[model samples]
Target: MSEFQTKVSPDSETFARNRKDMLALVERMRALEARAAAKSEERRPVFDKRGQLSPRERVSALLDPGLPFLELYNMASYLVDDPDPDTSIPGASIILGIGYVEGVRAMVFADDAGINAGAMTQKSVDKALGAIAIAERQKLPFIHLVESAGADLMRYTVELWAHGGGMFAGLARLSAAGIPVITVLHGASTAGGAYQPGLSDYVIGVRGNGMAMLAGAALVQAATGEAAQDADLGGAEMHAATTGLVEYLAANDAHGIEIAREVVSGLGWKACGPALPVCAEPLLPPDQIAGVVPVDYRTPCDMREVAARIADGSDLREFKPDFGPATLCLQARIMGQPVGLIGNNGPLDPDGAAKATHFLQAMDQAGTPVVFLNNTTGYMVGTASERAGMIKHGAKMIQAVTNLRVPKITLYTGASFGAGNYGMCGYAFGADFLFTWPNAMTGVMGGAQAALTMEQVARRTAERKGVEADEARLAAQRAKITAHFDRQSDAFYTSGRVLDMGMIDPRDTRAVLGFCLHTCQEARARQLNPNSFGVARI
Candidate 1:
């Protein structure tokens, strides 16, 4: 294995510019995340008065100390409600991720009840379903810190109503698949939300704060003229004693989390096998990664520089270095886990696509997990490329990426555009965990190129109609389209729309990839007994 030599210069003008741009993007991400946190913090006083923990505080207390919590989809609904970037916060009113609970790794979902009473919006439902899908696929136990006001009626959509059933179905599937579902009702869980705790294998209810009912008092009265108090209907005490909906009752939020942790500790679920081999740290400082990627994606840089900072010992075994110089394929290790790396130095040419196709098949044959570094404009165009069978070769590469059985992780390091996004295992391709750098952009094509394309179309249409083209109007339209695309292509915009799992700092790339790789590896090794139907309360 040869080490990838460094080509990035810290003092170079490009590096300096990239560092400044990267830092700015990072700040934007941090600001958005802080806004979401601040929104929750605003309710801290109310929670303290009620002797209850905030949603985030509850999550922190639920996980084991000194363990990493990989929060996912933190920007799920960003900029969706309003056009103003300053006011739109995008976490879908839920904090979800993977973390250690009593030494066992589990999927944790906590409703940000402090924000809008933890109302379930369309984005929140999508985020929940994504978490459920991950839990099911990874064979991880699902732990939900329930405290939702159910779906928002004001923003309701028929699509959300149709997809809401998947949440419950996913829960049942997880249980039947032998993955435990545990829930702690931290506060109100009314209407459809009540089923969350009901479907769980283990339920812990906080004595004074917990509430779960198919219909609240007002709703019950409206429907059947039956008078019922909140506590008598579905409070913690009632559920534990009368309905048997809750297996455990705790005095408060901390006690409830502790009880939930204890249940996980008692599950008898042991680690799959021995610890992984010791891995050497990368020779290059990971911090330098900020300068490795050009701030302007059009600028050319070696993708290997990224691999150097993230690969264990900065060692990489290049595959087919000459056959497809643009598409780089290599065998590398991250935290002692063997993985295949696929990255782009330029657009996917016919040869590059062919090389990638072959490389993916080989990696799959070797049963190695693959990581894709997406930084491509797309497949090369022009008559020469078409004559070179670009379409056929690109399709072959996409097919290989689509069919590979190994765990695939994708990182949007730079430009991800055109069919190149698809060929590089974009979100639609279902990368096990797709993460993007703060400076990343994802769209069909560059804003300028798309705008110019439309302008050409408009001009051609006018010419065909024997009318003079309105150059001023065309220019304005092009500018508008370019601005729109530029805004939409931003990492924050894509992240808010749940495009990638979340936007991560460039320096944290290795750690994030290693954590996900370990998770995927564990899931592949863990065995579970499946039943036709999930266990139901008797």
Candidate 2:
């Protein structure tokens, strides 16, 4: 065939028809090209400032270098203002994808802050749901780097009724699956949107950036007659120290992402069990020594510091630290075995109790063994606790412990008084082992206070004798138990009863924990059927 064909001129009518078709095709091509250009330009805005990295950049930093990120629903975009505005961003408000972190696959959703203040659109919700569905099917753990203005308002007005407002249902379903969902709160995550991270298993937050709560100060003031700043409303400190919502607090973005990656690396691919350690430390530190148990029980020690000293270095992950100031709960590895560390701080407020209950339930479900470091004054007292219903919520902790199938060990460090003693797995609380330090005091109430109970008899005797009450007798009575507890022999003998009753080993203070943790790790490994190099026994 010739390079150029011989032209056969068409009839006038036919030429006109052919021209019209060509023009229509050209117009459609131009429209398609315009759409393509717009889609190409719809990527995240340029990164500015040392503090702020784009959502994709943050996600990329978390995952392994150059890992394939297969984005879900990349073409999704919202219809703002007009029925279908010509200029609309693509990839939805959040970018959902499957990527690898440390060579292990993970389902990820990074909120695009550059897109409409990072507000979640109906399309974004669908994308998130779709990504979660993929994770569920593949059993991949989900990680969300959330930083958004919550539900997109412009697209959610009455005229745009088709645009769904919230993402509660989809996120709830993802959480219900019980797979490890790690949320890294990069920036402003407020209102209903923040709950997604709040409900997650592990929420890693930047010190000044990560915030998860019901409403911001502006909304609160608008709705109620209250004035509060963003920080006062739901800042990192509030969630960490007050609400106990944040699981891990990071120093900065780098630190936050590093911690998040560590969390994921720890989980591996398994959702049902914990990973074993490579090497076991013989004895952790001062926290487990039992020597310091009697040292000023009233002193407020950072439970995080205590847990760190006991567990393997950098292996302690505390949960709900803010909520339950009176009690401490941590998930950590001791000598390579996963164990839940529960302790008492003095007394936590009502909010603290609720947070503790939630942690207890989670720890139980994870099938991890628990170690209780008991040192509590009592349950919180006051109208706040009563109104919050500490009694009802605190019951969940007891119920969870009673129903727990895993091994539990309790060590009374100091004054395990009143309900606090019972809260931390008392003698009858079904703990596999219970131990008390030499100088520890576990009773219904403090010694000096209990001695004053016989006031009527003292008053009558004093009245008859026409003299002041005998304060010396009260001191003597209080000293009686103190003398008994002070005897090293008596302390060991009493501990022996605990040992005899299968509560704990009477000796080997710090070493016992290491041994117990090692045993637990071995047991879990066997249960999980880890890869073995040996033959079966006869």
Q: Please report the candidate that would top TM-score against the real structure.
A: 1
lDDT of 2 by residue, 1-538 (tens): 0111112223345334533543443343345334534443354343354375676678778878864554444444423222243554445666666677765567778887766667765556655655665555445678888888887776575522232333444445545654567888877888767777765778887777777768888788899979888877777767877777777888877788889889988874532335534753433343233222224455454444445555655356667656655567778776666788887767755666677667777777887778878767777767888888888766766777677777777776556777766667876786654555443556666644454545556678888999987777756765774544433222223332222121222134344566445433433443222222211111
Off by over 4 Å in 2: 1-50, 78-86, 157-167, 270-538
lDDT of 1: 0.91
- TM-score to true structure, per model: 0.98, 0.42
Cα deviation at 536, candidate 2, in Å, is 39
Candidate 2, residue 35: how far the Cα is off, in Å: 9.8
Evaluate model 2: give its TM-score: 0.42
Model 1 lDDT per residue over 83-166, tens place: 579899779999999999988889999999998889987888889999999899888999999988899888899878888889
Which residue pairs show backbone clashes in model 2? 244-323, 323-352, 326-345, 433-503, 434-503
Q: Using lDDT as the measure, which candidate wins?
A: 1
